[model samples]
Target: IALTDIGVGHDTLMAEVVPGIDFIIGGFDGRGIREAYEHPVTHTVMVRTYGGVSDLGRLLIHYDRDAGVITGYDWSRISLLAEQETPDPLIKEYVEKNIRSFLKRGVDNSGFEN
Candidate 1:
């Protein structure tokens, strides 16, 4: 549910009353956090997305085959900022193409030039 204003408002309460919901995606609070809680009946995982496209949240959920229950999870939030590495050719080309369109329209005035 896109809680683009309050950042998972009432989600904790929802977890208390609601049942059978496995994952909850919430964001727009400009901060990202991954938290897990054990309700009376089940466990719930909640993720808050970061502001804009500056980062990507990768979540890995582990489950046991023998028992029908969620075992655990591993999560990482990766930054999109360059960290001194050669850019991928295909991605660079695509970015250049899109930037060229913006440059042609004079909308890209952030001092970056080809």
Candidate 2:
């Protein structure tokens, strides 16, 4: 397993060249991948996040303990719905406070406005 910011093309090449790499996860595109891709030749499974804080990628692997290999897997991108999911009170408060502080700071040395 490996995490890389080198993008998918390089990741594929790395999988082809490197031995014993079963999974490669990462991409340079901030938009992220819609679905996981498995290389036909190397059989390496590739997964990427949906980007940002709202969406997250989940990978469930079925591994054989004795054989020490992944037999199968399931992957999905889960959307964190605000209505369904409740934010942690402490974290929410901290983030809100930070945002308020940033807004109060106004224009910076770079002349960037909020």
Candidate 3:
């Protein structure tokens, strides 16, 4: 497994160069992978999550302990919907406080309006 910020091409290159790399997770410049991809040559699974805090990527690997290798995998991207999900009180409070501070500073709060 590897965590990288060098983007997809490099991530794939790393997998090609290195042996026994079953997975690579990467993101760059707020860009994200809409779907997971596997390299044809190396058969390494690569996935990335959205850059901000709104979405999460999940990868579940099926491993063979006897063989010491990955057998298969499952991947998904989960969206955090505010209307469907309950917010943590502490985080909500902190965000609200920051919004108030930005407003006080005339920081153009229009962009943050939901």
Candidate 1 pairs with clashing backbones? none
Best candidate, lDDT: 3
Whose TM-score is greatest here? 3
In model 1, the runs with Cα more than 4 Å from the true position are 1-6, 34-42, 82-114
Cα lDDT tens digits, model 3, 36-80, are: 888889888889887776689899999999998778999998877
Winner on lDDT between 1 and 3 is 3
User: How high is each candidate's TM-score?
Assistant: 0.53, 0.62, 0.64
lDDT of 2 by residue, 1-114 (tens): 898888777887988888888888886765567788888888888888755565788888899999987899998987776776788899899978787666687956575875
lDDT of 1 by residue, 22-45 (tens): 766556567666443345555566
Which runs of model 2 end up more than 4 angstroms from their true locations?
A: 80-114
How many backbone collisions does model 3 have?
0
Model 2 accuracy (lDDT, Cα): 0.80
- Models sorted by TM-score, best on top: 3, 2, 1
TM-score for predicted model 2 compared with the true structure:
0.62
